[model samples]
Target: MVPMPEQSPPSATHDVTNQPPPLAPYDASADAALLEGLRREGAGWAEDGVRLLGLRAGGTEAQEWGELANRHEPELRTHDRYGNRVDEVEFHPSWHHLMRTAVAEGLAGTPWAEDRPGAHVARTAGGLVWGHTEAGHGCPISMTYAAVPALRAQPDLAKVYEPLLTSREYEPGLRVPTEKRGLLAGMGMTEKQGGSDVRTNTTVATPTDEPGVYTLRGHKWFTSAPMCDVFLVLAQAPGGLSCFLVPRVLPDGTRNTFRIQRLKDKLGNRSNASSEPEFDRTVAWLVGPEGRGVKTIIEMVNCTRLDCVMSSATLMRKTLVEAGHHTRHRSAFGARLLDQPLMRNVLADLALESEAATTLTLRLAGAADRAVRGDEGERAFRRIATAVGKYWVTKRGPAFTAEALECLGGNG
Candidate 1:
């Protein structure tokens, strides 16, 4: 009878999950550095956009979209059901929602959409806040924002696309630019052999009978945002390396020869698609004067480079917020993690760094706004701010991310 004592089941496990999941800050507008800097620097015009992004950044919808889009990476559909080479990449619905929200919030094209003082600063503030929700989709949004200044080098080219690019609506597809209410643009540089040395590109562009028109024949090693309506590509023309505007859909409702060979399986930025595209006699139009592609493309690159700085700064702020949130709820030894002395010191350091980054980024953005209005002092300061801020912030991102992740231990 003693041997008949009840035995417990073998497949039982303890319920022991700890450390709350770190969502975005409850209100990005309430960020001390962000609000203070905006007021001190006379960028109060951007407060409304920042507040809106703040309200959504920590919401359930943003959290779900941020998690799901990255979890479900984009699939490259090189062929259709009937075996036609469509070269389209299919995405989770979450990706589209993220893009639509970002576009409608003026995170991308606000500066170009409405030209005014504090325009770039306001847009930068909104972008920094929105970027905290998700970073991958920001790639296309940033590219579209940066593409404008470069396109302006050719007034004729800018005239056609500016309206679409600046539209608040978010239209995603391969439809004609004329038909779409909003548009996105991508950049194609860095061939397999060239990397950043675009001058070493071997892609050839032969002219058509029509002036300023050409057909490109070459391969792009890295093309960010393949789904974009149009891309600014660099190819060798009779006059040397030149910038050209290549559209996915040609003028006559026909798909161009821009073939997506394959999509890159990246370690990060899983929500966004980067690909190697083969341009087989791809029709394009010259962007700027021949052999001046570097000059024209540099304009675009500068804008993107500034975005890199701002994005890195936003990541730092995001890391601090997440770590701070986790520590406040997580317990260790005898008290809350944030209340402990050693943990407090570490977090204080991170907060200091984040604040510094926010100040510098917003200051630089303000400088850009002033530069456009012809301020020599701000223009000069911007050169130094951009170079130094980008170098310092990006270099610190990886290690900072590691430390912040450790704050939540296994929960991270």
Candidate 2:
């Protein structure tokens, strides 16, 4: 009789509740600060395209793409099964998807190609929106965008590569630059001994019989996006440190001497491949005046710094949005978390910081737009503002994200 006692079914203890819904399927362009800044920064005409990209970036598919891309980090293929040297970085399909979308939306080097007003501003706005999806892919995109001005230092090189760099097509693979529908760019400035002090680089560039052509010999400690079609490299020339354009594939369809020593084990940004590339007899073309590598690459550095500010702003905004959503739907102490005065204060503070970053970034974008239009005042402002913004905004990002994560308690 005791054995016949009915066993009680296991009581359910895993019911999901008090959790905010996924943040996708909402309009990322609906960001009040971003929209206001876009209009204020003279990119109002691009609002529609920005909104479209925002929607795409906020979709479930794009969210999944980001997750997958990060989860499956880029793999460096140093050699083929047949023992052939194939210094290629293989990425997940999702990575390619993100890249394709970014290129088609003109978030790479398109602004430099466009002759319209606010082109840079529009590109900046679009980049801010799309960058919210993922940060790693933005590396090559930013470099591609930055490479335009530096490449212009050598008009001959610019004439050959600029068109592809600005093309609204995502052509992945190492091929002759002219053969590709579009191209991406990367940069190699630092070495093992010299990091930010690029002037100390020891890579040697020996000029060939052909004018402007040189052979590079040395190792780059950090060269991100090695799979890119081209890279802006720094090396020691007869005239001193100088900048050179190194392509993965030479014009004759032969692989250049870009040996990927190994991929960097980074703390973050795993979706991008950062490598120590050994340049032994690597074919390169000199860019800018000899002995003026720093001056030649400064513009590219400024553009990348602006991108850093935008990236920081995007991070702050995304975290704040997550926190806000969680507080609105999550309840504790017999009321919605959003209703708590202390939580409200925290949210208000985060909102203020996020808005400030957004406003500052857009202002810099405006300055870039006007500066490119030959405004000396705007150019000067952009130079100073970009440096300050890069320093401040990027520094604030970790703290801002940490605080926003705290808002979600353990859920974060």
Candidate 3:
């Protein structure tokens, strides 16, 4: 293994990166009104994320991790499915802090898997929302990110899974978990030829001699969360392409034949786990209707995209939060940064722009709620909203993050 570290000894420096995390039960009741009963079920974890976000450095394991996370946000030379090192990759220690907080607070039940968005859906939809997209804003969509339950049910694969998606790919059996907090991963997608042509994907699903057992064959360009145990794989059936629940390992927790050709790197979401996974006659189970695979996946993907928006919104929020904190205290050219005319103007813009992003994300989430519930509406109308929300939010995301980052400056 070229690079895989689990529970390594803390560095002797003042950096608080290697301390034990703060563990506590998450208070679902407090945020219930805000996130709509997201903590109703699942285990309760201590929610001390704000503390991490508000770090002044030097404190508990949680605090140190937060500071370390911000310091080490960039990727460490790793490849995507196409053998390209993901350069823009960075770490979100604050996010990790929250993940651990969730586990400690009893918000998550799984040992290593933490699905806040899933918990959000399960709680908000009263169990109606079975997929991802939760508390932060809306039903985020990305089949790879949304299909987390598949990971929760399996832990042995966690070692191989988490490492595979890091900014640096682990060599062989070297990947391992360092923090006992929330873990996140991702994959890629496209609708064009040689560009993730989902419709024309050569992948096929054929029934085996045994019933309910199917063999997967063909090349899939993107398989998000390939490192995780559960895979939301899409394959063409007799009708059209659909998703299959392919585990990283078999029922007994053994690595399967599914081959990961390479990991693909990208500009945005650099830290998110992704790859060009290839399943060659791999064994899997058909999740829903044979012909309805793409349709079913669209539902999952729709929710995940919404998730991307939520995450984007949060990133935007955090960027401003850090920026505001710095400008308010730091002085520039013998004057307080915030008092400067130009600085104030920029800060105001950050405020309005971020607020706009948050509002739009919420509205989009509302529309998604209706669509997912199958409420009264013309198909064309829902389709338009889905398309627009997906486009508008994702489109608006980068500018938001960029502006916020600029506002935060060196500290951010």
> What C-alpha lDDT values do all the predictions have?
0.85, 0.92, 0.46
Global local distance difference test of model 1: 0.85
Q: How well is each residue in 214-233 modelled by candidate 1, as lDDT tens digits?
A: 99999999998899999999
Best by TM-score: 2
Model 1 Cα shift for residue 207 (angstroms): 1.1
Residue 92 local lDDT, model 1? 94
Q: Residue 232 error for model 3, in Å?
A: 1.3
Q: Number of clashes in every candidate structure?
A: 0, 0, 47
Compared with the true structure, what per-residue lDDT tens digits does model 3 show for residues 350-392? Answer: 7776666555544454554444345467234545665676677
Candidate 2 lDDT (Cα, 0 to 1): 0.92
Per-residue lDDT of model 2, residues 1-412, tens digit only: 3578766666664677899988887666778888899999888999999999999988889988988999999998899999999998899999999999999999999999999888888998898888778899999999999999988999988999999999999999988988999999999998999988888899999999999999999999999999999999999999999999999999999999999999999998999889999999999999998999989888789899989999899889888988999999999999999999999999999999999998899999999999999999999999898999999999999999999999999999
lDDT of 3 at 7: 65
- Which candidate has the top score in lDDT? 2
- CA RMSD of each candidate after superposition: 2.4, 1.7, 12.4
Residue 19, model 1: lDDT of 60
